[model samples]
Target: MRIAVVGTGYVGLVTGTCFAETGNTVTCVDIDQKKVDKLKGGTITIYEPGLDHLFLRNLKESRLHFTTNLAEGIKGAQIIFLALPTPPGEDGSADLSYVLGVSGQLGKILEAYAVIVDKSTVPVGTADKVRDAIGKNAKVEFDVVSNPEFLREGVAVDDFMKPDRVVIGTSSERAKALMQQLYAPFVRQGNPIVYMDERSAELTKYAANAFLAAKITFMNEIARMCERLDADVDMVRRGIGGDERIGKRFLFPGIGYGGSCFPKDVQALFKSAEDVDYDFRILRSVMEVNQEQKTYLVPKIKRYFGDLKGKHIALWGLAFKPNTDDIREAPALYIIEALLKEGARVTAFDPEAMENVKRVVGDKITFADNQYDALNGADALVIATEWSAFRTPDFEAMEGKLNKKVIFDGRNVFEGPQMKALGYYYESIGRRPVKP
Candidate 1:
């Protein structure tokens, strides 16, 4: 299939490159001339694992291309994917100007029948809005389909190459067939291609993210209760997760869920519910719980120090989670903000997220080249993100580097008893502060 992806953001670039990998001729269109130029020269801007290899290979093989011209990009293409940004408004509803603006332009430039796929995570009924925007000017027949992506940042390539299920929203048989054919190679492992109405498909993405957020928030609450009742959350999580019904993903208690998807999607869904005169009760609590969970370690740190003024703290991780540089609404950012507000100077380290944090928090805090580097001249260490490198560190080196041997393990990276044996004051969620 010949496909034109209208936008070269993370989703658009990944969609175009992945399609090109599967023997499709893909041309990605972007309004930014500089971005288009860079992509045209085989330079990928985002840092998704395994994406660069496929992007470079497809560019070399002539299957993937980039352009700034919408008309030229979509020329002779059977499918057009609108993967533009729909950032949240002040009121939390999604700002659909980008998606609708491009849709209106497609109406004017479209010359042939095509399947326009909404590949971005949009609010319910957005497909109809896109269809209406396109239908206003176009004389040709086109089918607007709601196809949301469920790709995780770190494992996007694997998720795309082997999706658990593909949801296609289209009433038109023609569009459905084309979409099915396009996704045929991906779902070869018998993972279903669920066909649903446009509204359902659009809401499915939000619902999935909201549920994941709620699940994580619920576990975080359990962890909080465990702390008060002198119970270990790890043991409680295992006790509950051992049941087949609950199972065990996202059960690990940490500094809350924060990513590009969960916070935005949950808020958008809440705003959407209000727009339609419905109050989503569970989601409201989920949002509240998550917000508190992000900064849950602040009080613990303060209690340990009695006061944080002029305290030099070592922060081990910055990214929300491991393996990606995305710091959007990351729990580490919340921790940093709280620490700075408390007059604590922080030296933070992350393998990938350091540069990203530098951009947001320019000169606000010092950065470390390595994990142990952050510990140097610091009063204690705080584990924010669970990067692989922070799992097993040289305790002697950490003890030697810090001004005093104190630790706040937010992700519960180490056993509490072990910290006591090492003769350090270590505090962790749902676990008593181990002092030896």
Candidate 2:
């Protein structure tokens, strides 16, 4: 199969590279000259786990290519994937300018019959809009298909190589058959390829993300209750998670759900419903709760020390979650802002995300060389993201470095009983606070 993937961002890069790995000739097109040049020079841009190996292998084998010119990239492509960005607008709706703009250009240069796949997460009916955009100037016939991606940042390569299910939305039989043939190698394990109309496929991505966001928010709510009622959230989680009806995934409570997808998709879906005069009350609540949950640890930290005017706090973890360097809506940023406003100086550490956070916050906070280095001279410790390294640490070293044996764990990485035995004042989400 010959394929062209537009907008070589996270999704586009992964999509093109993974397809090339499956023995397809893939050319990725991006408008940025520097990025295209970097990729062409054998430098992988993103820091996804296990992606660089596959990308380098494919690039080395000549199965993958990159180009700045769209026409050159899609010269003989049978399937052109529009993986452009649809960022949120001021009104909370998805801004479709990038996707539509590229579609218009594709209309003019499409030389032969092709299947244009909407690989980006767009609003419902975007396939029709894309088809119209292309139809305006296109001389040849093409089918616009909606095929939203369901890749998690850390494990995107695995998710793409072995998808649980493939949702393809196309009314045309030709486009459907082509998409099925393209995805056949992936879903060989009998994970169904769900075929539906364009609108449903577009909505499916948003629905899955929004539901996961709600589940996380609901657990955060339960954690709050457990804190007040003197009940342990871990025990409560175990009690409820045993039921088959409510599967145990996304049940762990933390500072909140934040990344590239949940916040943007929930807001967009709510706004989508609002456009038709419908009230999406649940989504609205999810938005509000998640916003508050991001900074849920701030109040606890403030109460621990009545006046944080000169306190030095050490923070561990900066990424939204582990195994990726993305920090789109990371709760750690919110916590940093709130602490700074309270006149507390912060030193933070993350294995992979410090450079990205440094770009955003600049000199507002100190970046540490390692987790223990951040703890040096700090009055208390705060765990924001649950990176694997932070799960177990040398408590003696932590006790020796910190000015005081105080910890605020947002991710509940350490057991309360252990912290109690260690004689450190520890507080975590939905669990009893350990008092030394």
Per-residue lDDT of 12 in model 2: 98
Clashing pairs in 1: none
Give the TM-score comparing model 1 with the true structure, all chains together: 0.98
lDDT to native, each model: 0.93, 0.95
**Per-residue accuracy of model 2 over 86-163 as CA lDDT, tens digit each:** 999999999999999999999999999999999999999899999999999999999999999999989999999999
Task: For residue 223, give model 1's deviation from the true position in Å.
Answer: 0.4
How well is each residue in 255-302 modelled by candidate 1, as lDDT tens digits? 899888999999999999999999999999999989999999999999
